[model samples]
Target: MKAMVTTGARQMVVREVECPRPASGQVQVKLEYCGICGSDVHYYKDGKVGDHVLDHDIVLGHEVAGMVSEVGEGVTDLKVGDRVALEPGIACGKCIFCKSGHYNLCREMKFFADPPTPGALQEYVVHPADLCFKLPENVSSMEGALVEPLSVGLHAAGTGDVKLGQNVLILGTGCIGLVTLLACKARGAAKIVVVDLYDKRLEFAKKLGATHVINAKKEDVKKRVDEIFNGEGADVVLETAGSVITIAQTPFLTKAGGTIVIVGQSAQSEVSYNFSEVIVKELTIKSIFRYRNSYPVAIAAISSGAIDVKQIVTHEFSFEDSKMGFDTVIEDAENVVKAVIKF
Candidate 1:
């Protein structure tokens, strides 16, 4: 088996590695596709995201979908040749967070592509059987790979309590931001406004059903939002850029009683926000970690045509050329919204 390993900043190599076999209650998947996430690119180019530093080489991918090739002992739910998408995080079931069903925040979790844990960028990966969700007949492997990010969007929307007839505003039109847009639309948002500095991404958002697209580099974002909602700010504001500027501006952009969801993780741990404004308006501030129990919902939505995950994919590369894929994503940020590696 071959795995794409990141040795250092802006460095990636494909090297042969031992293929892993399924352990008890686990299943080995011959991975078919893996999506390149913003966190993956951050680790590749910066060698670290916040405190999670890459001290040694590690495989970089988590949004994965493949077919089961072998099943380990006691794994009766899945068998060989079952098409599945891995949820990527394994938590200790004994923890309070897991016991309470907020396992995404478990104190001890082994998440793929997060430095120490080897990711699914290789030809084969062994994952716990329960974490692998079966894809519906109408969903393709590529769309299955997209389920991870869609789950993040779902979590963000759910956290904000998005509802029909509510005006939603999403900052940043990256993959996560676009998926947030899809999730809002699926939940019957009255109108969605997407803001980004890139024109290509704003265009993509419009095609994905955003009622209004604002180029932050050119348009006055605050004025546009006010105009769209007739002086009242958006009913729900989602900050997906993870930038200090965008996160700090949420209070001004959201309605007095609206909710603000922080979906993206910033490189800096802390940023100054207008707490006084939030207190005065009585706004609800919510934040999401990765996700919990969202893969099944995302899969069902894509399968039923309620969400079109594949439309966000703009580039594809073979597994052998995985390094090129990462390089292209970093160098061509304006054009490549999302890239996937096929095995």
Candidate 2:
């Protein structure tokens, strides 16, 4: 098996490594596609995401899907030929959070590509069979890889409790932002407004079902949002841009008694926000770490034609050109919505 290792910032090399075999209750998957996430780009470009710095060589991929090549003992549900998406985070099932069905908050989670845990950027990765959700014949392997990020969107919309005929304001046009738009649209949001600096990404958002698109670079965000929402503000405001400015703009953009979901992780920890606006409006503020219990829902939504996850892909690269893929994502951030490595 071959693995793409990140030796340093913006440095990557292919190395022939030992193939991992599945242990008990696990399955060995022949990886087909691995999506490059924002965090992956952060690690590749700056060698860190907040405090989680890259101290050593690491494989940089977590959103992945593949076919099962071998099933270990006690793995009964998945067979050798089953196509599945591996949920990247493996939590310690005994924690209070895990027991309470909040496994994404489990303190002892060994998530793939999170520092010490090696990611699934190689040819073969052995994952727990229970974490591998089998994909239906109607869903492609590429869509399977997307389930991971789609889960975040599902979780965000579900947290905000976006209902039919409700209005939503997503503050970003990145991959996560577009997926959140799809989630809000699938949940029957009447009006979806997306905000971003790049016109290309905003155009992509419009194609993905955003009723209104606002380029913050060209026009004022608060003014456009007010006009679009009839001076009321959105029922649900989701911050997916991961920008400090956008994060601070959430309270002002949310409607009175509405919900504000913080979906993006900002590089800076502390943000100056208007808590007075939150209190005055009686708005609800919620945030998600990653996602929990959303893979099945995302897969079902994709299968039912409620969400077209495949439309998010703007670029694709072969496994051998993985470095080039990462470079393109960094250099052409505005044009590339999502890039996947095909093995």
Q: Considering every candidate listed, which one attains the maximal TM-score?
A: 2
Clashing pairs in 1: none
TM-score, one value per model: 0.98, 0.99
Off by over 4 Å in 2: none
Task: List, residue by residue over 30-112, the lDDT tens digit for candidate 1.
Answer: 99999999889989999988788999999999999999999999999898998999999999989899999999999889999
Per-residue lDDT of candidate 2, residues 1-343 (tens digit): 9999999999999999999999999999999999999999999999988889899999999999999999999999999999999999999999899999999999999999998999999999999998999999999999999999999999999999999999999999888999999999999999999999988898899999999999898999899989998999999999999999999999999999999999998878899999999999999999988999999999999999999999999999999999999999999998999999999
Model 1 — TM-score against the truth?
A: 0.98
The worst-scoring run of ten residues by lDDT in candidate 1 lies at 261-270
